[model samples]
Target: MTAMGKVRGYNAGAMLLHWAIALAIILQIAGGFAMMHTQIIPDALRFTTFQWHKTIGLLVLALTLARIAWRLLNPPPAHAPMSRVESGLAHLVHFLFYLLMLAVPLAGWLVVSVSPTAIPTLLAMSPDLPWPHLPLPAAWKGEGVSDLAGTMHAVLAYSTLGLLVLHVAGAIKHSAIDREPSFSRMMPLGRLPRQSTAFLAVPLAAGLAVAFFGGGLAAGRLGPESTSLAVNAAPGESAPAATGASAWTIDKTASSIRYEVAFSGNPIGGTLGRWDAAIAFDPAKPTEGSAKVTVDAASIDVEDAFVKSNVPGPDGFDVAAHPTVTLSVDRFEAAANGFVGHGTMNVKDKIVPLYLPFIFTESDGRAHVTASVVLDRLVLGLGLQNDSTAQWLGKDVTVKLDLFATRAGAASPQS
Candidate 1:
């Protein structure tokens, strides 16, 4: 074989970093896509994998920058003459590869930066870059910045994947057909025999380790806050009745009903706002009360763009046709905990029954009610793949409600 190109061989440090970053990027891709396809994977593990992906990605960028600086300091030998087409393709491919190397992570960074919700920094977990949770003037949460960033991230990810596949094909073509050490010379370690064990063992172990640690960090460190949510109400002066006749008169000023949804491993969750509801209750007979609420199907919001897009959007509700989601009380029974209520939720064009276990308290003539309910998104035809059930649209959507009631004489609370 011709003497190895003087510029060809990568040093040990550069080679190690390259392999490590490549392995990490590959595993992250697999893990990420796998998580998207399979809901069975614990969310904590998914998060952990993402954290590691970010961490390693930052490391890759740092090393690549250093390599660029080093290349500038010590120039390499010139390439041999080649055909015009070969030269053009070589240059184009190399340029595209470099762009992917930088673009994928930067795109991801932008997506995270514009995230509408705050990402908690856990103890012992240091961020490689500045957290972008804080809102800038006139451009805060609910703005379209994150959506744009997210689209860019997805675009770059696919671009990178295409480039990666081409890179592998080019390497194999050069190594075998050209009978040159074009690919081998750059190997930090010397070329391996066909079907070498090192090729199998090293990459696999490293990927598993990274995935495990990444998943663990996300699950352990970045988990949701463990605190009960409470909404304070304006005080009242009169005494509450004890004849099991207390009824809740919801605030009329409230144009929206707000609550946050949290799951064991999900960093992203549902946020509901501006539910259109009408309360019908007998002021004198508090025990007899009912509520008719219609939530805008398009009003659902999520912190993560990926999760938001994955969630069935307006099509799930067809808010254009039926802009409102209605809920009507079916049954209410007093229990030691508070009140157990059953209601029929009308979403999209379908109605499903939901049960809510809640606590109702009457203080100084005012009634406060708080409850939680879990319902299937499938009944609403959410996450349907050709009308078949899929777990990607989790079967259960947990809803939390905290409504403050007042006498009819008071103005409705601004929702």
Candidate 2:
């Protein structure tokens, strides 16, 4: 039998495709919203959803194209001719659906192409296919392409949802009121009427699996490498001088490391400020130096509701009072991938010992540092869990620091 419905309508092939694409679209919609709304889903789950959305979007576009081609080749079963108003409405609706089906992915593709976020090529696959961005050899200069694409994608999503609702409502009206075999137009063939729950269950199960697994893979292990940029060590010259080489003065002009903080229950999340942390080292000796950092706490512009509400940074690292958080490095060690330094992180009225594993690269007599630290929030008394609602906020807060400090002056180790 043909893939479209049975007699006088679409056969099984077309029907199955229709249902499959419908399931994919629904999964994409749900997953997209879920990921946007909360971080509850682990990274793996988040990645999977993103990949699934991309995959399903592409599938919808392909299936729509195939359906169109099939119609051209074999033609849709003739429907009872409608009045002028009905014909116009039907035509407009079908056109809009097709337009959206094609446009949604195109917008997404554009967004991904220009964005630093890598795009996945195959559905449910780990390998990513990098596509070129809009700057066309740096000619189409500006961030405008990426911005426009993202906005268009959001707009198309909502518009398509509305269209889908209208389409379903129209189908139900035709089936119930007109007693038209409209639903049958896309029904499978030879499948006994009122088939067991598997019809719905199988697709539903497959969809859920795909959504979960795909998102997990994408966000978790299977996805591409994290889109993190870093600065590495470059060639440099140094001399052995008494009292060690002079300290590299902190360079405020250099790009400051930036991070985005997310708490489980925090209502707000945004960019934290940049700071200049200088490092002193002996190029000739390699391992002889320290790191000094002074952060302008007042400049820390965060949007996390929890942090905002907890005046003085939970542990009273109050910017209004102290205005700065300082870090003075003691010693450094070379690691397999990078370097590590044991130091003290000083905040308002407290000096906490910290062992920071950091990456250091030297170029032009300057060092760049990118350090990742997961600190026990309880130690700093960032008592984020005050109420029942804040209970979800975990005790460990992950702090990732990426900084570039220039060579300033050197001082003897204070024993």
Candidate 3:
């Protein structure tokens, strides 16, 4: 090799992109591992971490592409003198690193795309990245595709971990042990000391250890059996009678149904503003009483206009296609607290059995009722069907109802 072949330092743009991508990769590695332990982290925080990880992965992919183009347009600084074997090994590692840089995130993207959950990838909690909703082949549908992609992603991540260690060790050895300017070639802000490069390995090693072991621990703790809720009823059950005893009328202004879910590590709740209920009940004749409710799915107001508008979108309530959600309860039995009702709720043309526990009280010829129920949103086709999305958004949703009613011939409470 000629004396002039020795590289002095990397260009400004190259250095910046290198360090930025490195930092992002480290964060992504750590976050990805931590996110797997949803049982350990708070729900809202876990979901937020996932969004951030996804966003960073995409950014890394873009940066890697740009770096590749830049390298082609402007070749990297020449290497310091080395034996032919050393040179060949270095080039091989570099090539492998680049391949992994591209493949890891691409695998992750595929995992998300083929996911049955159909969860949207949002950037910074606002603008959503456009992801293709491609149909999987019959052989690759259901859990098969997601599992394969996920395995690929995990394997690629560990490969990156190994590559990262070798790359860092090589850089440190070249600069510190060999007393060469090899590491300096990629630094824009002049050459760092050999000791500093050696020290860098400490944190890198610590990070890799955390990511590998933490991910393994999380995976073990949160196995397939640990994450899923017990599904008691199948979808699409027949509707039951609403009332069996005395007929009653719901006071629209005095009744409301609300729902709560976790988003970004916070509890976000909203009311179904447009709904109607029919009640027929008598404390003396509990078996003869029944109740029914109809809700305008589009009328969900989460307080945030943006979220409210999207709640009825294709991935959400799909209000345009299925405008109404209905619930019917034909069986009512006395309970320790108050009363229990076995019912069925139909949303988006999908029906699931519902169990309602409620408290009822009457005074001044008017009855006041407060009831609550928990339902699996996926079973009712209210959201995406993938396991990851279910973990992020929570599978079970709690619905609470408050109502005041009067018998057909009874005087109104206000009157």
* C-alpha-based local distance difference test score of model 3: 0.67
What range of 10 consecutive residues in model 1 has the weakest lDDT sum?
225-234
lDDT per residue as tens, model 2, 1-415? 1322322665454566568767777776667767777777775455456656776776676666655544444445654444577657767887897788778877876775564222323344333322122233343323576677778888887788898888887778766766665676667643323222223434443454456445544453322222211112222112222233546654445545443333543333333354555566554443677766666665554443223324333333455556666667777777777777778887666788988787768776556667877665556544433322324345555566655544445321221
Ranking by TM-score: 3, 1, 2
Candidate 2 accuracy as TM-score: 0.47
TM value for model 3? 0.65
* Candidate 1: Cα lDDT at 159: 74
What TM-score against the true fold does each predicted structure earn?
Answer: 0.47, 0.47, 0.65
Candidate 3 residue lDDT tens string, 22-53: 89888888778778744666775776677677
Between prediction 1 and prediction 3, the one with superior lDDT is 3
* lDDT of model 3, residue 338: 94
On lDDT, who's better, 1 or 2? Answer: 2
Candidate 1 stretches with Cα past 4 Å from truth are: 1-43, 47-249, 252-264, 282-287, 310-315, 386-393, 410-415
Model 2 spans > 4 angstroms off: 1-7, 38-44, 116-125, 128-143, 189-415
Residue 26 miss distance in model 3 (angstroms)? 2.7
